[model samples]
Target: MRTRAKICGITRIEDIHSAVNAGADAIGFVFFPPSPRSVTQEQAKELIQHVPAYVQTVGLFVNASLDEIEQILKQAPVDILQFHGDESPEQCQQISSQVGRRWYKAIQVKPELDVINTIKSYQNVGASAVLLDTWHPELKGGTGHSFDWSKFPKLDIPLILAGGLKPDNIEDAIKTTNAYAVDVSGGVESAKGIKDQQLIEQFMQGVQRGSAK
Candidate 1:
């Protein structure tokens, strides 16, 4: 099967167009205020307006309240919700059910946690997929750091690999983990919150090459 790609942390209209043109299956908009790539509801609404129907739009949140999420969704046309914080399975289910959207939970891969069990836990709680990201105590994600790909466990649910993936290493990541899809932010950026069009294209090419192998 062809490996899918999600180009995340979109902050501008140009970047959105670039990602779409580069064949991104999904585009993510950060709603967490602490993230440098985060956008306002109005900003996300405007950016999402330019996105076509086929490309999925994801909203990234960090332990946001239902009210906050609802308020944002009221304006922005987000297709999926990605929880990237310390939300419990029940909390995730509650929010997703209330919003009536499929959701993904980001699992920060740490040596102490049983990765397989964590994935199963999220799946049991109704997560559509589990996004694997590098662990950092201070930063939830977008750390530009990579975890040990060798440690990934076999999973029934789709694995969306994230953290430190660039055009150079995306092929290696896919081949190693056999991930269903890949999510990239800092990897395709000229700077934090600034995406490079060429990098986006190269990343997609890498995904194609990796899937082919």
Candidate 2:
């Protein structure tokens, strides 16, 4: 199967268009208020309106409460909900079912953690898929730091490779890990929350070329 591309941290309508034109299968909207990429519900609603029906719209949250998740769901109709925080499988499933959307769990891989058990934890939580991200003390994703691909363990669920992916290294990432899809945020931006079209295209090109190999 062809690799899927998700151009995350989209905050503008034009950027959404660029991602779609570049063949991105999904677009991410940040609901967390702490990060620079965080966008308000009103802004996301307006931006989401311009997106086509086929492309998925993902909402990123960092340990968000059920109330907050419900609020966003009411304000905007997100196609998928990405729990990017340290949420338990129960929490992930609860909010996902409450909102009635597909939930993908994010695993913060540390040095000593057992990779297989990590996958099992999310699976037990009822996540449809998992995103492998670099764990850091100060950051809540979009950190642009990559983990060791050799550290990746085998799994059957859909894997989305995140953290520090760029046009230059994306091909190798896919070839080595054979991830079903890739998620990127700061890798394609000149500044926080702002997308660079050329970089976006280059990233997509790299994904296509990598999958072909």
Superposition error at 163 for model 2 (Å): 0.5
- Give the per-residue lDDT of model 1 (tens digit) for 95-194: 9999999999999988799888888888998999999999998999999999999987677899899999999999999999899999999999999999
Model 2: CA > 4 A from native: none
lDDT of each: 0.94, 0.89
Writing each residue's lDDT as its tens digit, candidate 2 over 108-140 gives 778887878878887877888899999888787
TM-score of each: 0.98, 0.97
Question: Which portions of model 1 miss their true places by more than 4 Å?
Answer: none
Candidate 2, which ten residues in sequence have the lowest lDDT sum?
150-159
Q: Give the Cα-based TM-score of candidate 1 against the true structure.
A: 0.98
Candidate 1's error at 30, in angstroms?
0.1
